[model samples]
Target: MPVTMPRMGNIHIPFKALFEGLGIDYIMPPPNTQRTMTLGTKHSPEGLCIPFKMTLGNLIEALELGADKLLVPGGYGICRLGYYFKTQAQILQDIGYSFEMIPVGVSERKFLGIMEIVRRLSNNAPWAKIVSSFRFGIAKMNALDNVERKVHRVRPVEAVRGTANRIYARAVAAIDRAPDYRGLKTAVSGSLAELDGVARNEARPMVVGITGEFYVVLEPFSNLDVENELGKLGVEVRRSTFISEWMKFSLFLNPLGINEKKRVQRAAAPYLNRDIGGDGWESVGEKVLHAGKYDGIVHLAPFTCMPEIIAQNIMPHTEEQIPVLTILCDEQLAKPGMLTRLEAFVDLLERKRRVAAGTAKAN
Candidate 1:
């Protein structure tokens, strides 16, 4: 099987590392682009969320490029994501697109389930090799995310615009070529060091925490690259979810009794009494946890994403008092319009900060 999976941010970096280390044959389709979106939208059922359409598009593009085996991550949850792989496969079959789907149901079996998926991809490679590849893959994932964290901080504070992004691009390239865990670490360190070398502004940027549906948070194209735009406006961006953290919870920690799910559930408290599907529960908890540390929170979700829509509605009712902005995204969103909304939000935050400072001084 020539394995190919949908692209979400830099997920392919670690995915490639894992497959190669296990001697599994894999192919990555071209990076997601407008062409991919257009194709997906054309074939997609109306009213489906953007993530569904996007991943369906990714699979179709990969198949057209000679990919025979497709891997689409799956889960069992209240969200429609549980049905994504099945539905996408059926859609392709209906359209006469010949391909095989290796659906990895993560939510149902968690780590053990993923192991089964990895086993299939590994082509019966020795268990030792499989374990080793998993280790290396996870290390690369953490390395990539750590570099991203530094880039986020540097972006808002850099004296020269685009410096952080340039360094970040280099880091990603290095990560892709890294041969082992050690090389991945070195690549990450070198990238962060370069980012640190960028000259910084005197004033501290307002920290903004972002939370919402997982796909929209990670895929820049879906969210119109909100983080970069925020950085340009001098706002530090912190994500509510990263692949490294999510993997830790879902794969390693949960099975080992080091889970953080309970803590997040507790934080969410009365606002969301139960899992409302997707990352809705976590979105609420992330706000509560970061309320004191961040100046504001932005909830980005796909159009009609029920979990995030529920989370967004509950946000204004939270007692945390942190300002919240909800941005619903789709193919129709324009960059200029998104930027204008962002600028208005930034202005509001700045005014609130100034007013708070003045009141503190008066007291």
Candidate 2:
């Protein structure tokens, strides 16, 4: 069976590595584009979040390309994400596509659940090979995250516009093509080096932290490439979510006394004492934790997403030190409007910084 999965940022890179290592034939869905959005919007429920629409489009495209089996993320959660696979499968079936959908319930089952899914997909490969392949995939994910972190930092200061973006793209392709751990490391090192070598301005740029729904934060297409837009405005973006970090916190380190989620949840306790579903608690927690450090926070949420809606309401009540801009993303969100809001917010932060600087000098 040729397996197919939805596109989520550069996650496809690691997924490709894993399936190849396990000797499974898989189809890589085409990159998210206008067509993908249109297909998903046309078929999906009116109130479903943007991630659902986008991933549905991905599976539809993959099925059209002869993929017979679908691998989708699933689990029990407060968010509608838990129900996405079932609804998406039904929609695909109603549209006349014949395929088996496998839900890898990693959120509910954690590491063992993930291992079981890998084993099921591994074509009876030995346990040793399966573990090795999974490790390699994880290594690629970490490498990708590291390279992206560098690119985010370099983008705001690069002397030549788009220099950092070009380097980052090449790095992603190189990482995706890497056949082994050594090659992955080399790709990351070379990419980071290239980013470091980019000529940069001497002036310090305004720094902003991004927090919100996981899908919009990770998938550039869904968020209108907000990070790139912020970079273009000469703002350093400190994003709150990364796939590797999420995996490590949710699967690996939580049991061993290292828990990022718990720490954030503790910080959020004063305001949001309960898990309000999705990343609402984490969203508030991040703002509380990074209050004075970032110049501002850009909260990206899918239109009609309840968790983020709750977060958006509660964020204004939190620490007054940092400004928060909540952007509701959907098909109707236009670039011009988003850019205008971002510009206004950045200008506000700049003015605040100047005032603080002058106050300090006067004192």
Candidate 3:
């Protein structure tokens, strides 16, 4: 089986599609786990983000499962990620795994180049067929990305408990189980079908834009299911990053490049003076501006996330006339209470907006 490395979030859709499209049987490592953490930390260079270490461990675990090949992407610049791929490969080799390593996007090459190599190595498919397969995979990926974005954006709206979120959860499940191009496209579009009846004005829930460390924002477990709870309470939600944005970052690699540290610095500059952590600034700016456009800002962070904490502190100073909530969670947060607080926060924002509107009318 081809051993695929776990992606940072849901961004690995295209390559997953390409593999299945070629009929290359692959086993995806389970989402990062404690075992994965131990393996990564045991092997990876110190000082890397925990996520990177876990991903490396994920690959190693997959190798132990008898996967013949490992699929990883090589970045071009900024953030230490550009260097991570090569170092990880060397580490794996030192551990004596005789598996083929496929690195996508080396030296700023087009993604098509990556697909071409995958085609040549994974299967002996003709060049034309490989390109066609890649396109189909990309199409499905784009559709799936669209649904995820829509669900995330609508999460802050107050709705019946577990209503919209349940549908999205199912949709995400569908995407995960999708077996081919057709299945993927259906899964992507079907997610939106559940939201057809939601009226935007039925609930004037407060909007909360979430920003922080990439993994913190992307992974639900890490963020304590913040999006799901916010939606149940009728708060509209926005996230600073998505699979689509990552594609843009991958394709352009500047302005949209893989510069997490610089992006965070830039985003937090309105609140702080410089870049504090890798790739956190842009997300900081996005959250503040998004919160202003909506009703509030909620920055999700793991405990001790320095850059994000700094950004969280700076956010309240933004002249956006919005409420700011900084939620720090680790493995010990209470689920039900977190939901309650989100509901109450949305309620407060709704009341404030109505009062402000009324006062403006009277004036």
Best by TM-score: 2
Best by lDDT: 2
What is the per-residue lDDT of model 2 for residues 143-256, given as tens digits with 9 covering 90 to 100?
999999998999999999999999999999999999887888899899999998999998689999999999999999999999999999999999999999998988775557
As a TM-score, model 2 comes out at 0.98
Name the TM-score of candidate 1.
Answer: 0.97
Q: In candidate 2, which residue ranges exceed 4 Å CA deviation?
A: 254-256
Q: Residues 6-96, candidate 1, lDDT per residue (tens digit)?
A: 9999999888988888788888877888887887888888799999988888888888878889988777789999888888988899989
Comparison by lDDT, 1 against 2, better one: 2
Give candidate 1 misplaced runs (Cα > 4 Å).
254-258
Query: Candidate 3: where are CA atoms >4 Å away?
Result: 32-47, 86-107, 110-113, 153-159, 173-190, 198-201, 252-278, 301-321, 326-358
lDDT: worst 10-residue window of model 3: 256-265
Question: Per-residue lDDT tens digits of candidate 3, residues 233-344?
Answer: 6666777666556555554455634664346456556665655544456656765445547787777765555666666766666765577677765544567777777777
Model 2: residue 155 alpha-carbon error in angstroms = 0.4
Which whole-number lDDT from 0 to 100 does residue 346 have in model 1? 92
Alpha-carbon deviation at 108 in model 2, angstroms: 1.9
